[model samples]
Target: MENTKGISRARFLAGAAAVGLTGAVLPAGQAAATGRGHGHRGLKHRGVVYTVGAGETPGTAWSAARMRGDVRVIRDDLHADTIDVTGDGVERLTATAAEAAERGLHVWLQPTLGDVPEREILDGIAECGRFAELLRRQGASVDFSVGCEFWLFVPGIIPGATVLERVDNLRKGNVDMARMQRRLARFTAKAADVGRSVFHGRLSYAAAQDEEFEPVDWNLFDVVGIDYYSFFPQPADYVCELRRHLRWGKPLAITEFGTCAYVGAPETAGMGWDIVDYTKEPNEIKGDPVRSERTQAAYLVELLEVFESMGLYAAMAFEFVTADAPHRPDNPRYDLDLASYGITKAIKDRPDDPSSNWHWEPKEAFHAVARRYGRRAGPGGVTMAEEVRAWTGPLS
Candidate 1:
């Protein structure tokens, strides 16, 4: 597999490892942070926007406040059914949605069916169906981006068919164009199904060539959805590639995007920690933290500008919170202890044995995004300070 940024997957992995940063585990908190930027002023666009998950964290809420777009919440583990929507969950999500709605944000409910154990698939679908119904009863405008990145999880074909293939399989098995239309038809036919819209979630894989392109059944959706990381070389490259697959003319939404940052323990006990470096060729530490964050922010700004210029419908950043992986301790898929893509760091406070893993913390890129989109507060408002400063120097 190749990253959209022109780096082959193997090369990117090897390069990343050489820098002392390892592991690209999908941060659940990253996915959950998708909805945090929904309500800020000046962040307006014609696109159909959405966020990662609907966790009721302050960080998530703050992020949503800065986004001038629609909101979508992952409804799998968080609120899969009425039983899961306990008093706490209900209150939290409801408050979150209400806050978003007040800021002109539309909420969509998304559910995934394939990543879990095979035994859980049927239960997942059923849970999704019920979850959609329950949210509707609550008078919320609910929709489902059912079965996220199905292609990424499907078995068979090559042993390592890349992440894109796995996501494609997910869609094919559950809701491709033909299947999606049928499902929608049935869903519409049901007598009591009044308030929900169901769309297929097609997570884009990191394939740089057409030979690796996985076909999507775009005809079955009311809206088109994709997850983007810093895979492509530039935002323009991504936009061009995206335009090719957008034959159906439905609105498009980016399900994810962000830079990865790794953290490590301090070199000396009482001394301040040294940032992991990723500069050298043969195992030299040269991880460019500042560059990574700036690049991510610049890419998002450029991408959003292109979407606006092209009159594309929707786009959402990857997420809001800095989350930790629950299953990382035992997983041996990779070597590194931390995933560095989150905007915030997750750190455990202790005197001597403080966490050795990279802590997840907000980067300047996060603030840059907030400012550029008019999602922040105060006098200067939401201006692209970084870009402006880069171009104009100090504004006497």
Candidate 2:
């Protein structure tokens, strides 16, 4: 995805104007909607939220403060402890986590999995161990798995890969549902040893009839994590799909999700619109702003309400920064220009920049949450089920 440089200021403003729909922004006290739902109560502590950004990028820290999120989710590979040897890198991450905690925010460590040119798998593990130790030393809690979409990074029967290569790669990685189960088990054990709370990140495959492709291994972690970015018009079905995963008695977290601007109605169609694409150019939904904001905000609000009502865990938005400025080319993670999803463009040091186009903003959604539920504790920390019921209404 290309940066918004060529996009004139007038065009950006037009796009924002198109999506500026009117709706009551619920306050913190009234944000939780009345819904009769039942699921396992997650950790009662306050939820940790973040906008995904480059690992340890200054933008991430700034966004956390701007959004008022309880935590900033960052890639583990970005940590100096993992990438730098002087141990100063780990110290920086620890300090960041400590600062977040002090501000009532937590830090979520996301370590990517792949063959690093400079570091071997053992080295990666050691780095992860050290990073984990740093979090512990800093008294920071909350951790999530790195990208577990091995199918995408490696090879798979997906449309992107050829059949032969996909088969070969799958065989090499043991990319079967059972293999995922085992891998998750080990990963969970490791993360638990580091922090009692953990989330396993995974991709949401095309809706399939079998559990294997559907990611049914939610039992492996305290929170069931999945990436959700739907191309369809209605989002209710996707929400239901997630609800099924929540049946595992764990909370739910969306590891990644954003509108792809370039994707057209037909898969083979050329890029008709240019925005932030996750895999390609024009990855965001560009046509309508009013419908877009309402749709997006409603989706998030509904999901948060559902999770709260069900006593499930929290969810984090996919990203905070845009792709164009200070791009990390060596990292495939930073290959695309998906930075438009950021509340603020990469250039501005401020939280909400009116200059760039945003799918969501910190002040709107962030304030809505803080106002409604900021003072109230989540199911994980609060044990008074009856009192919660009286406050938020009955849970089925």
Candidate 3:
């Protein structure tokens, strides 16, 4: 959950005092990415994750992308059991960047070089370089995340081969922080080496929100990145807790954060996505949207307040759209929408229209976030019920 567990759709890794490096070592084949053109020094990063596949996206908007977000975290060329970044995949990857660049948005390209095998990881990074070059040519501001949680997702990066196995191992107390940190440091440095060869831009990996991230030397990347989630029972202390991360002295970004759609969803904010039964049909699932969606909307407002008050560099909403569980007509029992953390709901594609495919309609949280980014709170300085209840959607 960073889908809240920092791993959902992690389908999700570690390291310790493995600290600063003497010199930035650019991985082979991508020396040019480390060149002088990189810059993202001052940016507020009002971002939304655009989960993308080849040329298709997890969700598309009804008319056009609303000006709600400034930074578009394009999840490009990522791989899982059924996903692999092939030639076509790379094209799919750059295509989203082209669209984002056209919208005048800063782009954070996260390319999942396939898990395990050294060659696959290298091949993935090379393609990311190619994609990065394509994005830069489009005049889009770009930052590169070598990988997400690699320790668990990628094979051979840690002791366990699969995510479940690794999670189990961690639970059973098999984690070796020192060994894990050393491996991650080597791998990230390697990625930097290769990444700099072609795409010269800001680079950083999306680390987990957990303490396992301690080994990473934040100084290696341009911006200190972390996929944070409100896994805690009460989010009231979020601002206070952030002091630890800000101590890194580098610009910080909440690469990921969001709450699911459900009445008691906030309690499971960190890993709600995992609680759903993906095998079920969306329409068949049913829940009280009024209570659930409102809860999600309120959660968004609370988090933004923390970000603004804390003065963090930037924060990206966990996601803009989710395709796994989309909004559909009738039925509610199997509704995947209830379990999603997307700010917008995915409406099925029009079967009759040729020009349009699908659409993502804004949730109440969308307006709430837009209001926060404007440096103002919802309606009355900041609202939970009113801001959400104002909407006329199914959830409202």
Candidate 4:
């Protein structure tokens, strides 16, 4: 049996090395923060969004991460992998929470609220609340999101009969973004109101940076979070864009930000998922020429530079490990490593026996993040007077 609390795999994720750490430093040019912005009173949100994907049930990868103890917060994601929030889903969440608590890591539970009718929207929140209570009573600090990428994940929210169509709708620019932003704001506020009744800690949704967040009522939650990804076209301008959230005054957390492990992954920037054709099993995907682990590592240096230089609230890498996607050197077609955002890579095993490599190995990105966080662990929070300002009211 695979040890739930032990590290069994040797595969590590993509390029997270400290190569050229001084490459592209951007100036976060707007006004400096007056004090620690409106993050939680005592906690600095340094965590990873650990996903429990479906591969002989969930929590295997997440549990391995919990035992590592490098991350201070655990953004245990339940929705991205599973199809529904059935009883099994709730149990998986409890297991995630138990591991987090045993390791003394704070937990941010994210449940995917699929496209249910508007009237049944609260249904999602109800499920999240139940998990929150279970985690809280178990002595783990818990945060909850109503859902992830509501417009795309949920049906009817966007004009699509299926998720792929909705994604295509977004890619084609067919969906009305302005209307979606309004819906997001309304649902976010409602989720918070309902969430407050059961869960006791911070609350914020994982929003893609591409989304329109100006209308979001920042005051409704403790922090403003963005799944901020850096594209190749925008580094200097990226700082200017990130500054937009600074106006929110609450601690703006980069909820999900990461680069993939391929060679030219950074050059392609923010398109790892699309890099490999998913029509084949993750292991059967073909690897491209542009693949360079160094390229991926370089982006880690770039983003970390921007994040530390900006002195924002907190930062979590995209994830700890991706299941099913493994590395196979002989058959490049099975190199799922190209499309993975995980800090660790899963070892390539026969499809019939994934447990052969029950554990994963570390990747270059693993050392890079550990090094960065190790540095931050020294100084702790940003200086109120010099780098960041205090929490003020939300933007007008």
- Give the clash count for model 2: 33
Deviation in angstroms for 349 in model 2?
Answer: 9.4
* lDDT tens per residue, model 1, 1-396: 221111122223332233222322222221212122333322223222222333222233323333222223222211111111101122333444454433334444443322234334334444454555554565644444443433333222212244444433433442243543344334322211221232123211111112122334555555555544433435455545555435555555554444433322111110111232224321122333222344444544555555444444344443443322211223222211123333333342321222333333445444544444443222554334445465323321
- For 348-387, candidate 4 gives per-residue lDDT tens digits of 4553455554445666666555444544422563332311
Task: Give lDDT tens digits, candidate 3, residues 285-345.
Answer: 4435433666677777677666655555556776766644556555465456666777777
lDDT for predicted candidate 3 compared with the true structure:
0.55
Q: Which rank order by TM-score, best down to worst?
A: 4, 3, 1, 2
Over 4 Å off, model 3 = 1-43, 54-88, 133-139, 160-165, 168-177, 231-236, 278-291, 349-358, 374-396
Off by over 4 Å in 4: 1-43, 56-88, 115-121, 133-139, 211-215, 232-237, 280-287, 351-358, 377-396
Q: Model 2, range 193-228, lDDT digits (tens) per residue?
A: 443322222211111112334334444445556544
Ranking by lDDT: 3, 4, 1, 2
- Candidate achieving the largest TM-score: 4
Q: Relative to the true structure, how large is the alpha-carbon lDDT of every model?
A: 0.34, 0.33, 0.55, 0.53
Winner on TM-score (3 vs 4) = 4
